[model samples]
Target: MSGNRAAIRYAKAILQEANEANAGDIVFDDMRSVQATIRGSKELRVMLKSPVIKAEDKRQALLSIFGDQSKYTHSLINVLVGNKRIDMLSGVTESYISLYNEAKGIKEAIVTTAVALSSELEVQVLEKVKEITGSTNVTLKNDVDASIIGGFILRVGDLQYNASIANKLGNIKREFSKSL
Candidate 1:
């Protein structure tokens, strides 16, 4: 199976276990911390993925890092090490985020503009998107593209609303060509 699928499966299992243990919130926080750790440390990732290291060594290392922090997290790390699936750590973290978002009913949106938007404009746009999507929680990622010249593009998951000058030009060009 793909790494993402495996990670998602592992995350689901971990979530189930956390619920059973009455430590769901703790597990979520631990997963977030682990994700941050993986993102911040390339050496740590290499060490975790190294076949030369024994599972016990990996577990000990995880324990040293997160042992006292949260028992559920420590146990989860040990389980990953025992399974020799450290390479999926990043994916697992992402999966956990997705699960968390689902639980919280949050949606992420990306908005790209030719220029930076004012704080008020940004808030207005976010509010509009939240209203349109009916999402209680919305996270926005902004991108600036000078080539766009003007207007903005809003992307909500697989759907995109493009109102950029570049797209307008392309549309006009297409229409002109068809008329030729």
Candidate 2:
């Protein structure tokens, strides 16, 4: 939507600014922290999206949470608040991470399994993702979801390979219903 497009625009602008200052990596770290902090706190999320709160208060809250950011990051806060788009902070951070990874030529693969992946399994998954993406710079994130029961789901960019037991069971149930 428009909001996402705007977030991407803001992310691109900030990335360019950071790169010009040779602080892209530092800003990338700041964005990751911002994303994690925003994702972890419901109150923060609510405040960002709340129209009842004044822009100054929201800026103060964000500054308090991420006061140690780089100059570019602090400038970003001011710009977003000035534009009255502080509510898009989370989206902006998420877009910034995606843009940063793409700029760095790093592909992120997410693997969801019933339990945490062992070291060997993680290595194997990493190798598989590298092969699939044809990129040596690949990062793997392992997520544990008990509902999957067994097997794993691998996601790289827009590609998703769902081999979870839950999916198989659902397919089987669909087939039975179709036959009847």
Candidate 3:
């Protein structure tokens, strides 16, 4: 939890700098790339979190991996390395993206279903999420979870609606046990 808070602080500072330089969009894309790169590579994640790796080494590795990034991104890397908080890079990127989206009045929604949603269904879900959040700009992410069996789970910010078949079955089982 404390780590997350620290990431948020770093992200806000970077966002402010990027906005002041009129490079918020560029920095936003760079952060997305950073998040995706770190998320995609297991070795990179391990290296970032490894106590044995020197902070300077980690900084150099990141710089080479993400060459040609915006000046703000390079500064963020330098700051994190100096503070010995490079391991929080992924968290910071995520927080930055979330903050950017929020500032742009864009909301992100996640829907977990047993199967991939069709284009028509995705459009419907986007409309529903927009209506619920009262935001015209909404991004929907679909996650497939077979364990749900059927139905879907929708999450928008702090609000979650679980309409999964597994949840209903669990509730029924609990009621049956109480009656017995």
Q: What is the C-alpha RMSD of each candidate to the true structure, in Å?
A: 5.3, 2.6, 2.6
- Candidate 1: count of backbone clashes, pairs at least 3 residues apart or interchain: 0
Ranking by TM-score: 2, 3, 1
lDDT tens digits, residue span 4-64, model 1: 7789998888778878888778877787788778777998889878889887887788788
Structural RMSD, model 1: 5.3
| Candidate 3: worst-modelled 10 consecutive residues by lDDT | 1-10
Q: Model-by-model lDDT, in order?
A: 0.80, 0.91, 0.92
Measured by TM-score, the strongest candidate is 2
Question: How does residue 177 of candidate 2 score in lDDT?
Answer: 100
TM-score for each model:
0.65, 0.86, 0.84
Candidate 3 local Cα displacement, residue 150, angstroms:
4.5
- Please identify which of the two predictions, 1 or 2, would achieve the higher lDDT against the true structure: 2
Q: Backbone clash tally for model 2?
A: 0
Q: Tell me the spans in candidate 2 whose CA falls farther than 4 Å from its real position.
A: 1-3, 114-120, 143-150
Q: Identify the candidate with maximal lDDT.
A: 3
Per-residue lDDT of 22-92 in model 2, one digit per residue for the tens? Answer: 99999999998898888779999999999999999988888888899888888899899999999999899
Give the TM-score (vs. native) of candidate 2.
Answer: 0.86
**Candidate 3: misplaced stretches above 4 Å?**
1-3, 114-120, 144-150
